[model samples]
Target: MFLLIRISQQLINGLSIGSIYALIAIGYSLIYSILMFSNFAHSSFLLMGAYTGFYILILLSSSFPLSLLIAMLGSGILAVLIEKIAYKPIRDRGNPTLYFIIASMGISIFFENFIICTIGPRFRSYPRIMQTTFVELGKLNISVMDIYAAVVAIAFLLMLSYLIEKTKVGIAIRAASFDLEVVGLMGVNTNMLISIVFLIAGILAGLAGEFLGVKYTVYPQLGYITNKAYIAAVFGGLGNLKGAVLGSILLGLLEALITGFLSSAMRDIFVFCLLILVLLIKPSGLMGIQKQDKV
Candidate 1:
């Protein structure tokens, strides 16, 4: 009974965290599908989302939902800005990979420090409006926040899936996903689509940031936490949204179980060990079957 309870709790935690990672993975995959490897600044955008909400709440005294909307929109705008200024020119150049990756790292570093400068070097919680409630379920303890986070993330996932599968924009993203150059040649206004994809990616990261900030706490260096999700993204396949989400959920569950069974300190190491093992066995990731091409 104890083990079962432990597993249930861990599973819930994992799903929650994994879903957040999946959000980031979506950001990575969307850009990857379009521009191929233009997603390194994603984590920084998440930080920006949290900070965006932090200040919007302080400045306007807004409610949680409203604050979140502002944050997501703010971050989405920033995502577009980053693409235009930081990534647009460097894309597809001879040294695009090296230059862009470094630029992304620079963005990440700048945000990490910028958060420190703006919010100070301590952990901060969102406004009380974002606080979650707890509920009891037949000896199984559940929190309203957990349910809310899971539901919102899942809903976003569904919306994203629908967007990719149903609408005209979905058709474009799908087409671009398969063969961006050809789609562009077919007169799809590929640049506009790419910009929209970055904006969408930003919104997703902003939502994930809100999830992290409200459920946990907002810190200046919060993007560091999403590193595990980065690993999951790579493990699942860089350009594969389904793979990234699946891997994130799996890793989230695994980490939660480790934390429950052992100690928190061991959870990170344990997860990486498992990840390495997975890579060793599966190589291209459990779902990285798309296969990178060689020049």
Candidate 2:
């Protein structure tokens, strides 16, 4: 019974953490699918979202839901602006892919430093918006925050799936992923489509930032931890939504198990090892495509 309880506890913990990874991975996958390059600046949007949500809760109201909404909107707008300011000019000039990557990296560094200079390097804990009590199930104690995070993550992913699968804009997004040049040639406003994609990615990033802040604490370097989500994206299959989700959950479970049964310090080593193994065995990722077929 004790062993079973331990296992269940790890599973719940994994699910909670994995859900956040999945959220961030979705954004990464979306941008990579269309842009054909990793936008390191995604870290900026996420960190900004965390700080934005934190201030909203502290200054405006302690309403968690309201903070989430505003954070999502704020980050979404920021993402669009970034695309316009940094990425758009390069794209218009038909510059090499390296320029986009360097720009993103610059943006990331700028945001991190800006936060440090403006807010300092100290960590800020979120307000106790939700009770920390646990709900027991047959000797297993489940955290309420874990359940809430998992539920909200799942709900948002579902909504994203629906938008991608059912809506016209979603169809355009899918088409753009396959061939942005072709989509534009087909009369679709490729620029608008790209902005919308960034918007969706920003919204997901905002949710992830806030949830992560609640689970841990808000800090300038929070974006560094998002590297795990990037790894999850590679593990599941870069540019594949389903794969990103699966990879994140699996990585989360693996991390939880390692922390539960092994040393916490070994957790990161194993994660990178797993990533290496995945790349060696299947570079396309567990759920990613191996051909020109795009998600």
Best by lDDT: 2
lDDT of 2 by residue, 108-224 (tens): 999999999999999999898664778888887777887898899999999999999999999999999888999999999999999999999999998899888887899999998
List clash counts for every candidate, in order: 0, 0
Candidate 1 residue 170 Cα shift, in angstroms, is 1.9
**Alpha carbon deviation, residue 288, candidate 1 (Å):** 2.4
lDDT (Cα, tens digit) per residue for candidate 1, span 1-295: 9878878877877787888888888788778776767466888889878888888888898888887898899889998998888887886464556787788888888878877886688988777752556777766767787788788888988999999889999899989988888898998987789889999999999988887888888886688766777788877876777888988888888888888889999998998888889888887677776456757
- Whole-model alpha-carbon lDDT for candidate 2: 0.91
- Candidate 2: pairs in clash: none
Cα RMSDs, all models: 1.9, 2.0
Name the best candidate (by TM-score).
2
Cα misplacement distance, residue 104 of candidate 1 (Å): 0.7
In order, candidate lDDTs are: 0.82, 0.91
- Model 1 lDDT, full chain set: 0.82
**Model 1: how large is the Cα RMSD against the reference?**
1.9
- 222, model 2: CA deviation in Å? 1.0
Task: State in Å the error of residue 8, model 2.
Answer: 1.3
